[model samples]
Target: MTLSFSPSRPAYLGVVRVSAWYDLVVTAGFATPWSYALLHGGLSSVGDALGLGVLPALDPIQTLYANLMGSVVVVWALLRLVRPLAVHGLFDGAARSLFAMWQAYALAHGAMKLLWVFLAVEVGFGLAQLLPWWPSRSNEVEPALQGR
Candidate 1:
């Protein structure tokens, strides 16, 4: 007798893809407001000391362009997940590799940190495929596998 694992549900994949897309959209939306607050609301003091002052000084147009480009990349990732066949192997593989790296970063860096919570959620989205279909007890053996 042998136990078997089933393929993941389509709904799970859909949820993961949608969640990733939503995260990208929300982050893009916040970029402008956050950048504005950082530039004009006293954040420059700390940024200047940290040698990161140049970022906040970016004009709104420049910021929007950067954010839009980032959003496009994220959307591309989501589309790959939703329809893997539509993307070429090299591009899909690269996106998946990057997604894995981002997940590792989120986990190793401590997700509880304010800036990392979104990363944590992104990790969850990527890992949705690993969720178990049903709870199991360590000592339990199913009838199908009992003889093996």
Candidate 2:
């Protein structure tokens, strides 16, 4: 059997939901001061174990920024998790693209290699959600019936 690259709405929405879950799992710790303290230690340990340099000691300003970012992202993720709409995928993909770009910039400016892991995920999900999905035959049938 041949693999099909045709866009499937159900599959696309599934990807959106999966991406949302990933964000929730990864960033939930950053959404609150208490959780971020624990997360900071965990991440620092992982970095040291992987031979990446340890993360710097957490500062109040840094924690504040992290919390703000986490709060926004968690809300966005929840929206996608609840609705899993194609439009949500589009917006999420755009945000992921931006995040990946910033991650790359930080890496270039001496950010830890550990960030590469997050960057890879951001790029993967961004592409999966943002790739063009136009129908091959607009006149043939309704989109819902076209198996798209």
Candidate 3:
């Protein structure tokens, strides 16, 4: 019997990349509708109900722009993950940068809960890249040493 070990760094990265892409796609699809609804429906009613002194009207163009910006940021973050650079240096740096930007955006928008969720996802992805998974060794019989 023999034991062999294999590392799965590439596969881990591939899964991360796929997850990132899926996020981007879903967000992109949701962005337009959400922004439109926020601008047209919620903002005014919420502002009036809260007596926020005539909140600024939502601009569809601005909403679209913000959505595009978010998509771009997310894509950049994904790229950082997929880049074939040193795990510790380039990948980590890029991930941190992107996550910081996301946090800032969320804070600016008063979306703390969303920000936390995004932060968690970002941290999880970074940790996945940082952690190494060593393959399990197979059980094998070994001979005992004899002493005179």
In order of lDDT, best first, we have 2, 3, 1
**lDDT by residue for model 2 over 10-64, one digit each (tens)?**
6777888999999999999999999999999998899889987667899999899
Off by over 4 Å in 1: 1-8, 30-65, 77-113, 130-148
For 1-148, candidate 3 gives per-residue lDDT tens digits of 2323111224544644554665565355335647545544554565456654333455667677667766664665466456622233224435655766777686577642334555666666555544432123111111100100
Order the candidates by TM-score, highest first — what do you get?
Answer: 2, 3, 1
Can you tell me which runs of candidate 2 are displaced by over 4 Å? 1-8, 133-148
For model 1, give the 10-residue run with minimal summed lDDT.
Answer: 139-148
Which predicted model would earn the best TM-score? 2
Instruction: Look at candidate 3 and give me any clashing residue pairs.
Output: none
Which residues of candidate 3, in runs, are more than 4 Å off? Answer: 1-8, 30-57, 60-65, 70-93, 100-110, 130-148
Which residue pairs clash in candidate 1? none
RMSD vs true structure, all candidates: 10.4, 4.0, 12.0
Q: Is candidate 2 or candidate 3 better by lDDT?
A: 2
TM-score of model 2 vs. true structure: 0.85
